[model samples]
Target chain A: GDKVKQSPSALSLQEGTNSALRCNFSIAATTVQWFLQNPRGSLMNLFYLVPGTKENGRLKSAFDSKESYSTLHIRDAQLEDSGTYFCAAEAPGGSAKLIFGEGTKLTVSS
Target chain B: EAAVTQSPRNKVTVTGGNVTLSCRQTNSHNYMYWYRQDTGHGLRLIHYSYGAGNLQIGDVPDGYKATRTTQEDFFLLLELASPSQTSLYFCASSDRDTQYFGPGTRLLVL
Candidate 1:
């Protein structure tokens, strides 16, 4: 079984719409980070959360260490938002490496 | 600008061949990591380093070895390459709690 399980493995939305992605962890994570892998296969950092919430432009993310879960909300989705969204969790005891989920492939259609 | 660079941009090798993927970071971060991305599985860490001359095993380190020769240079080596090792590789450097990723290296094993 995967320590970090992402829900809605694949999602589709229309431009200007909105959607949310979630990650459930069983690793007793201490921190969480979200990234968007664009079409060019480049991973871009979206949010770094430590048991709290953060907002950037139309993207917002929240992480709950105690609950071992995190969420990413995308508003006013654009075509450029179409990519694979990945969530990684940092456990307390390891060498401070990240455990990533399988990821959610998001497709934004115009 | 903060950046992580990897090379070669693309590679192809036969089974039992040797391959080395290189990474460089200009952010002057203390932590560096190597990861591979596949279709279903997003990204899995292969190796990491706290600083120069330090190496740490990641979740999926088998068949892979890594060395951090300098603060800005980290290298991943495949002693005996196999078809299963073909995938996109990414290097990352983390400062504070945020991680910056490289453009990625695409490897094909035959």
Candidate 2:
């Protein structure tokens, strides 16, 4: 059984459209982080949440510890947003270790 | 933004060979982690440390050794490389709240 499960293994979106990626945790997650792996293989942290919502630029993320899930929303997608998005959850008893989902590969077309 | 850097951005080794991946963070974070990413697994934690001279086992700690010698440096060692160990490795640092990742190191074992 997977500790973290992601939805929509892949997604394709048009530029200026909106889409959301999700992660469900079977563990008692205390926090969640979202990362975007670019085409060049660089993984960048996009959001770190603690059971709440955060918005930066056109990206918004929410983590619900009680519900054991997290979501990352991208608004007005751009061509540069074509990449793989991963959500990682930190369990309550872990030593700062994160369990990651399989990731959602996103392709934004012009 | 936190700055995390990895050395030998790419690596190649043969079976039973030895290799090491280096990571450094300038953010003065207390926790550091090493993770390996595969095609379907996304990312799995290999090891983590709370501070220098401290090590903690992660979910997938087998076949991997990690050491934290200083607050700014963490290293992952592969004493007996195998083809199954070929994947992208990532290093991350966290202030106990948010984690930032470094540029990944791609390893190929023949």
Q: What's every prediction's RMSD, in angstroms?
A: 1.1, 1.2
- Would you list the C-alpha lDDT of every candidate in the order shown? 0.93, 0.93
Chain B in candidate 2 has what TM-score? 0.99
Worst 10 residues of 2 chain B by lDDT: B95-104
Candidate 2, superposed: residue stretches over 4 Å from native: none
- Model 1 chain B worst lDDT window (10 residues): B91-100
Candidate 2 collision pairs: none
- lDDT per residue for candidate 1 within A2-33, as digits (tens), equals 89999899999999999999999998998999
At residue B77, candidate 2 shows an lDDT of 99
Instruction: Give every collision pair in model 1.
Output: none
Cα lDDT tens digits for candidate 2, B19-60: 999999999999999999888888888999999999999888
Model 1 C-alpha lDDT per residue in residues B1-110, reported as the tens digit of each score = 56899999999999999999999999899999999998888899999999999998888999999999999999999989999999999999986478899999999999
User: What does DockQ give for each predicted structure?
Assistant: 0.85, 0.85
* Cα error, candidate 2, residue A60 (Å): 1.3
